[model samples]
Target chain A: MTTPAMMYVHDWRAWQPGRRDTSQPRLSVAEKPAGGHVPAMLRRRLTGIGRALCDMLAELDVDADCPLLYASRHGDGERTLEMLDSLAEEAPLSPARFGLSVHNAIPGVYSIGRGNRRTQQAIAASGDEFAALLVEARGYLAQGEPAVIVAFAEQAIPARFTAHFTTPVDTAAVALRVSLTPAQDAWALTPRPLTSDDTAESRPQPSDLIDWLCGIRDELHCHRPRQAWSLVRAE
Target chain B: MTSELEQELKHLIIDTLELEDVTPEDIDPDEPLFVEGLGLDSIDALELGLALQKRYGIKLEADSDETRHHFRNLRTLAALVEERRTA
Candidate 1:
């Protein structure tokens, strides 16, 4: 039997390079890399994907003590590529780039921006990133965390590594505040088994995915190499 | 040393660290650049060292007090650049 919704979504925001904030007036890409939360010192050093993630974060009104979960299929690809290139050239690697190339780098920066020291986790499960993140959320809610902020993003692979990836990697970032007992309608995840008709690689682009998250879409099913789950809108 | 070299060093520091709000004039040569004046942390120290190495071909004694002395401020950094730069 499908279990009850393990968690609820309180609020969410999804960001793209040229996308506009419907809540605010027109803001150019140049104008929206970071909001007032990120200081100039930190903002100046953000990569493009980092910028998108930070911009999405600024829209979230999370508590100072709220836990955070950052999930990405490929984390910090550009910075990792730069460090690799530096190593190949036998040159000293940029310390900043090296430090930011780690999986939890952007979330660490966000913690600094918000002075948040709550329990934080970063996940990089191959194709089931979001699903696995929700599983973590379910754990947090089960353990009595009032809420958890979920941040997910993926950027285009660097030119040298583009040929390694078969699918067109779309750049996007999404932030969501999930709680156990939310004021709004809650969502549930039902574990599913993969089928021959599985459309894993051919999933909708990020923009459409964001729209699906916002609106009432059909059951969103995602399958990894070894596992699968269906996100259902349980009313 | 000429003021021009010190000014160049200031610009280098600002650019390398991505200190968006600070201008060369804002950084006092005598003030501590770490933890007090410019408020740079340990990561900034390593980043600055790497930038100096890339731009000037200068190698730092990674754990030496002498290296720390050279990174004292703008004047000290420029002095190291003047003495050690190959490019």
Candidate 2:
């Protein structure tokens, strides 16, 4: 089976330098905090996970009324940590933090901020975040109209939850606009079984996958069918 | 502070605000009660207003400026409740 579709990929770091690369005729969104030499508006909006989603959606050229799909590997870790810390200290949890702690709060906040009624937030802790997100996005594509997907993953883990995994990296967010319109620039999705002796315990890390995707300057093939999908990075 | 009013307000705040780790006695009266005070926001204010209106038959006027002034603190909210109760 083949899924032929047009997709635009954006990297938060590349868009930091404030030079517009109009190679793909698409808008770009990045997560750059203050003092990062990036544009002030971009820096201001992409503050936290929920804010990042909202900012990214705001930057897209898609019709404001179109549906959105937001996927995250780990959603709202800072808020989770804060809640856990409050519980440990026996202090009252901030109601705002409590509301932002939910995994779907990113999408909910974006919906509220944009006044859009159609949005879905998907959180997949499993190794195949991109694959799961693709499946979800495909459902939107099935509607025969354009849909936007904003997928982000950050690296800051709370010390209280350190025992859960092993990885140290910074944050990254990517927003892609996908439509049913067939275009010359598109990536093909193909699934294949694993022949290597790679067990579930030895899966590729999120940072590693992100790095590989970001480094692609030309046509590249991603082999991990269950966990991998290719993006034609907008130049 | 009337015991019944205090108790009812505490329960309503706890339930409406979803203060999972707090009980009625934990909320000290006369304490500053927004953000750094109680960490509540405009959304919580609307929610609490709705719950209070539904439960006590009191209506918070839709004027944003008026609602902000009325929801300044628990004391103000309590005073409004007292007024509505008497009226």
Candidate 3:
């Protein structure tokens, strides 16, 4: 019997900084005005960085109908900072802010916006967020449901917390749309580290891996950030 | 002329609202308090109202149309607080 199919992919920066490939550019925070088509209530508190990620997923055709697995290394750092700052000053926390400060808020918002009721898994690991998510997606694939995995990582944090970890200069979001089809481009499930290096010697970062899969680039070098994850056909 | 009342009000706004990007001086007395102004939402109104009652010993009548008028802006909120403080 053929092994079940599992795919891993990534999308970095929703909107392009300049004219580039087919990857759609991300929208600015200011662009997300009140009552926009994007489920405004669910996303009002998201920072520009967070909103950029949601926009990227929406652009990639991630709808509520699809099963999704969302993984984030450091989820909602800005909200965490705000809450901690208020608590430190002996100020009453804003209820709205407190509600959205949870680690699952990113996936929660995306699910609500897309009206997706499918099972969604949200996880935050010390450094194995990507690996953990890939394993989860494999589980779904084994269960016989096509899985769409979105893995995102953002390094923007308050300096108080930044001093503890390696400072990430940029942010990224990557998504993959995976399904079983009669094609040879299926991705094999493998456990590995989340690396920033894109060299062939080093395993490709999620973003570079998707780029290579899409044939956008032959290879990506080290230092390129990896973002969201998804499944795509190998051409 | 920073009266104790004004200072109290400023402290209340800063503390109750959790306005991180805002300081007491940054809030203009006449600025609209919601939407185009400080961008406070409906949830903020509820929490601020609760704080006002507990901290200032003022019972803001929920049904009164005056409640909306009183919460229109900081100046109005301050006026209500001043009126209640004296009474």
- Chain A TM-scores of all predicted models: 0.80, 0.66, 0.66
Q: Compose the digit string of candidate 3's lDDT tens values, residues A54-97.
A: 66556555555666677666777767888898899987676767
Off by over 4 Å in 1: A1-3, A20-32, A58-61, A185-208, A216-219, A224-235
**Candidates' RMSD to native:** 6.2, 12.3, 10.3
Q: Judge the docking of candidate 3 as incorrect, acceptable, medium or high.
A: incorrect
**What tens digits encode model 1's per-residue C-alpha lDDT throughout A131-221?**
7787888888889887788887888777778788866666777778888784645564455567887776634344545655755466566
Q: At residue A105, give the lDDT of candidate 1.
A: 87
Among the numbered candidates, top TM-score falls to: 1
Order of all candidates by TM-score, from best down to worst? Answer: 1, 3, 2
Best by lDDT: 1
Candidate 3, B5: how far from true, in Å? 17
Number of colliding residue pairs in model 3: 24
* Residue pairs whose backbone atoms clash in candidate 1: none
User: Sorted by lDDT, highest first, which candidate order results?
Assistant: 1, 3, 2
Stretches of model 3 off by over 4 angstroms after superposition? A1-37, A61-63, A167-169, A182-235, B1-87
B18-75: candidate 2 lDDT, tens digit per residue:
6655667777666755665666656576667767776777887755776666677667
Q: On a 0 to 1 DockQ scale, where is model 2?
A: 0.05
lDDT of 2: 0.56
